[model samples]
Target: MQFVCPQCHISYPATSQRLRCAECGGPLDVADRKRFDPAAINTEDHSLWRYRAMLSLPDGARVVSMGEGMTPLVEAGFAGQPIHFKLEYISPSGSFKDRGTTVLTTALKAWGVTRAADDSSGNAGASFAAYCARAGLAAEVFTPASASPAKLAQIAVFGARLNKVEGAREKATEALEAAAGGGLVYASHAWSPLTLEGTKTIAYEIWEQLGRGVPTCYVCPIGQGSLLLGAYRGFKDLLAAGLIAKLPRIIGVQSIACMPIVEALRQGLDRAAPVEKKLSVAEGISLARPIRDREILRAIRESGGDALAVSDDETLAAQRDLAQIGLYVEPTSAVVGAALKRLKVDGVTVAALTGSGLKSPPALR
Candidate 1:
């Protein structure tokens, strides 16, 4: 597959290390969309690799796996209604970011990359570090100095060098980009199209768990919009294969403190504009400007979905509510619960719990 810019439509070889379009600076996507063939599934493989036929990895690429994906879809009551919760936090790295990290790491290994760098608040960094360690590659993670101590420790424990940027979360990304310019592979979960190749497996699993049927709606928290966009792409593949009757409505949740995508949708804009960043309990989804904002908005709109923002109070209350139901998740994941309450969606619905409560600071838990 080749890397294609959605905006300028510039094509680059799939082996190109550039993360964004050189002409328009837009995020890249895998140009050749693979058709999903259920017959091609490796049923014996319980991990995300079960859908390897649909993934966009190069031929003969060695997979870097840690038993990621195939998370449980637990049915529970929420707001007096039955809801299916996709427990993505039960991953090897304690967050859903592992899905993306695995594919990215595998590609890096195939490309003969020995060192990689990435920036994340916590979950992505930890996931990348763990996968890099598994792949025997040197890894460096740039994180905000104010990130959760537990997550910072997790990254460092994986033997990846940690660079704590002193300012905002974006500063951490800036630091990683500077290093990437110096020849380090930027295994960016947010910007790299290969990451989405891994993440799209979530939809495939969800489809399988639902008896090969699609849900009426799917909900998830959006930071860089990987999970949501990936799910959208996966379901679209199913639609193209005539496996599902139609695409599911995908609702993206964001913290009110930093809701660029929500605001962009509310204003009917094609792209998200920068918003004032504020401290939020759901630090994972507190991005002021998502790199894939336009693609995210397009996915939501195409799927007949809507974007919603919830307050920290609502998110915390939802966290407690989820814990009471035996589903403990981070504040970022709880935003879906809050949004669900507001939506009161009918028919079959699934909410993706992206991160584990164990990853949160003790006080938040």
Candidate 2:
């Protein structure tokens, strides 16, 4: 299997030291056009690493696991409303990002990489740091200055070098670029196919829980559009493998305050354009120009999915609603819950609870 660029169509070696396309520098995915196993189902392993054979990592690989898979897809009742929340915070990093870290960091460790660097709002940084620590590798995190302190602290606790950048995430990302001088791999959660590979496990679990069938609709917040992209590819794989008959219509929710991809989608643009970010509690879904923007939009459109934006206030209200139902999630996950009210669907729906609210801003409580 190999991954091709959504923008350039140039293929990159799957499971190689190389990630992005060298020609156009675009996002990559598995090359083979194969799908999931419909007839044969396996649920022996718990973490996202359970799909090891399909993954690019070496055989008998020593993976950095934190029991990050098989999270409960609990049905939630809030304000006389029916909703389902995927408790991703139950992962090792207190966020859904552990799925990706489990794959990326383990691959790095196996390849003899000693140090790494990445940028994130919170959950991803925490996930990377925890897994890298477990793998005995050094890590550095460059994050927006406005990012939640508690989230940054998680990376620090693991002894990862923490560099806070002022201004918007664009500025923070630039800071990481300026400071990076080779030797340290840019282990960006947004750029790591392994991380996305890890994320696909969520789809696998969801399909299994649904009696090995795809759901009617899948909703989640998109920052760099990792979760949505992962599920899209996973479900498509299942469809290709003849395990599932069809793919679920995906809905990617984002914060209106910093909605670049949403704006692009609304404008019918495939690539993500740069934008000035506005403050919001859902710090997780904040991205200006995601590398995989084109693929993200295509996934949504191909499945008749839509990308929508929600206000921070609406997100907080959704959070309160979920908390009432005993599902505590960060503002980003709440954003998904809020968008669900806006989507048109009439079947079993799943909204991935991307992170625990406890790790976000304290005012959320």
TM-score for each candidate, following the candidate numbering: 0.98, 0.92
lDDT tens per residue, model 2, 69-106: 88988876644446567888888878888888888887
The superposed Cα distance between candidate 1 and the true structure at residue 356, in angstroms, equals: 0.5
Note each model's CA RMSD in angstroms. Answer: 1.2, 2.3
- Compose the digit string of candidate 1's lDDT tens values, residues 45-67: 99999998888887689999999
Clashes per model (N, Cα, C within 3 A): 0, 10
User: What do the candidate models score in CA lDDT, each in turn?
Assistant: 0.91, 0.78
Worst 10 residues of 2 by lDDT: 33-42
**Top TM-score hit:** 1
